[model samples]
Target: MHWGYTSIGASTYKGFDVSYTDLIGTFGINFNLFNNDVVRYYSGFRLGLIWRETTPFPAVGGALGFDIKLSKFYSKIQFYLGMRLWTDYREDQKNHFYGDSSGYKRGLITNNALLQENGAIVLSMSW
Candidate 1:
């Protein structure tokens, strides 16, 4: 499940989030466990971008999380938790070029669309 809290003034915050998951099959799938009492641990890549407004800083960031599945019979539910390694907004003009770089013109200072740090968690139910 993804969630975020936006601070309106000082002690107030507006928050929201969303998440989804998919499960193809249980016993018919080769990835299924041979025993019924098994809880399967799975790992894959997670990638997504988020956009937030009215935030202290307008930012964007991608997320990465690990996934695990708990199963019984033919039904299973998966949960994910991970972190993002980059930011999502152009917060400031850090490495931005404002002018020419060939020593011909004055270079302008600006913030490039640099990445930021972000993360999220997710869960899914399937059979």
Candidate 2:
């Protein structure tokens, strides 16, 4: 079990600059390549609750990265880049544009359909 967090000073969302934060939690595995044990690679799926001006929604995706074993204040450090697709992202964002609407415009998913209209690039660090 692992927990994470992130903060963005500025970012581009649909061509506009935005700022936000996230609280993340993940479960996955780490494997040591060639059994060297010095360098380990890891991949996992993640789910984050995005906190932004518009609304809070879940962004879920996977990540791939590695762990470097360093002898210092932080013995193990990880750098990962991930893509999180929002479950409530509308294709046109018209709902956010028009205050509110019915049906899918209001972030609804129907009959086995996944709301995958939006996504986010995630860069994070952990020790």
* Winner by TM-score: 2
Q: Give the per-residue lDDT digits (tens) of candidate 2, residues 1-127.
A: 2333333232334543444455656545667757665455566566656655666756565555554544335446655555544343223334543345444332343332234444556565556
The true-versus-predicted C-alpha distance at residue 7 of model 2, in Å, is: 15
User: Please, what are the lDDT tens digits per residue for candidate 1 over residues 1-127?
Assistant: 1222111112222452312121111111112246532333332222332223322323333333333554334534433233322233333212322133233222133233344333445454432
Write down the worst ten-residue block by lDDT for model 1: 21-30
lDDT of 1: 0.30
Instruction: Tell me the deviation in Å of residue 46 in model 2.
Output: 0.8
Query: For model 1, what is the error of residue 97's alpha carbon versus the real structure, in angstroms, after optimal superposition?
Result: 20
Please list all clashing residue pairs in model 2, or write none if there are none.
none
Evaluate residue 55 in candidate 1 and report its C-alpha lDDT on the 0 to 100 scale. 22
What TM-score would every model get versus the actual structure?
Answer: 0.28, 0.44
